[model samples]
Target: MAANAPFTPPLALASLSGEADADWARAGAAYAGAAFLGGIALDADSRAAARELVARDRSEFLPDEPITFIDRELAALGDVPIQPAFNVRSATVEPVAEAARVCRDRDTLLEINAHCRQDELCAVGCGETLLRDRERLATYVERAAETGVTVGAKVRAEVPGVDLPVLARDLEAAGAAFVHVDAMDSEPVIADVADATDLFVIANNGVRDTETVREYVEYGADAVSVGRPSDNPTVLERVRAAVDREFGLEATR
Candidate 1:
């Protein structure tokens, strides 16, 4: 199945009037169209911290439900796709799993991010660094698989010789329902994606336009996640048009 197109309006619900938000999200999502919605995908490190704080505040322990934004977006769009994404890591798996459980209770899927390698993130042993910890990554998927709602592994196109394919295979072997590849690599080697066919393959990153979707298809992505274009309101409608143009999704206009 396809994910939501990117459509991050940069407007926090708490900071807006209900009327203003309804208007903005409607205009933005409608413009972003049928493409997948791009969102902040909670920061993995932030989730760990948020979980700890949430745990402390509760006299009786309850699972963390940091999916406030996802819920908000879904409510705004009604039937449009709004996928949950994040630079989640092995370290954050437990809290992430707990959050995913909460999402599953509501029929939402939790996307596990393994692509971000920001300086602050790498320093914390999250994101790409977790890639080096294969065992940890496997444990995460196998554990989440027990929840029966399916968890996604979002990995960047890296891993040297074998490239993203090997990573996707590793994730699939680990029980991940889908292995997500970030199309950030310009020199994408389509041959490297064959190993992913056994499992669901999703593409994202650097997909700022329609032509990029063609490239992602050429590279063998089963489905793709549109990020920047769908998320940025300035180009949300532009992206929706692009998805209709490129992927051939029916557009209302």
Candidate 2:
């Protein structure tokens, strides 16, 4: 584990759209070093995008009073030792700042969402579009960092024309503490970003077993995040055991 990253065992439960709430975090608490709650819609544009997703029968968080919702959910996790983090969606900077303030009060991580590739979110400038708009994303990070909370960004890998290493470096310059990468079929890019920036890299995508865990570890990822199978204790336990063994090796060297 990276000494500066708060994720203890260096494993995270990646946020499932609308499913990764307080109870979900509590359930995975024993396995994950961090539980990312929500791909919550934080502003008008994101809320609109979320509603569009919901219209298509997809799970999307469209909470009324977004900041209060964050506070309430964090409070509900009462005494779970897992680090609480929110993966939030917004098309502008103010909501990111507001969400960061709530995270600061809770001592949780606030991750700006630039990884969601849903067309509705992209059309609204809330998801993968943010990854393409580097300056705007950096501004969001800068504002969130101002609140003195741990700030990070959830970014996608393999997006054409987007240099993730450069974006990671830009985010680091803007005061991000970590980068949660959704390595959509391009696992080696985790190494690229890890080599390019000091940001604690949490690699996501198809993480289920020791082989997967060891692969990310060998690729220079500081941690790995479980996405679809995060709810399965069998998988979490398997991955957690692997993390202890693999990351322990890193600690030794």
For each candidate in turn, give its C-alpha RMSD to the true structure in angstroms.
7.9, 2.1
lDDT of 2 by residue, 153-177 (tens): 9999888999999999999999998
Candidate 1, residue 72: lDDT:
57
In the range 1-253, model 1's lDDT, one tens digit per residue, is 2243222221111101112222344444445322222222245564453345345552111124435654554455555433333223335567556645654564544556555565444565666766676767777777776787566666665555435666666776766666666656642643366444466566666555567657666666555555534336655545445555655555434
Candidate 1 local Cα displacement, residue 238, angstroms: 3.7
Evaluated against the true structure, the overall lDDT of model 2 is: 0.90
Model 1's C-alpha root-mean-square deviation from the true structure amounts to: 7.9
Per-candidate local distance difference test: 0.49, 0.90
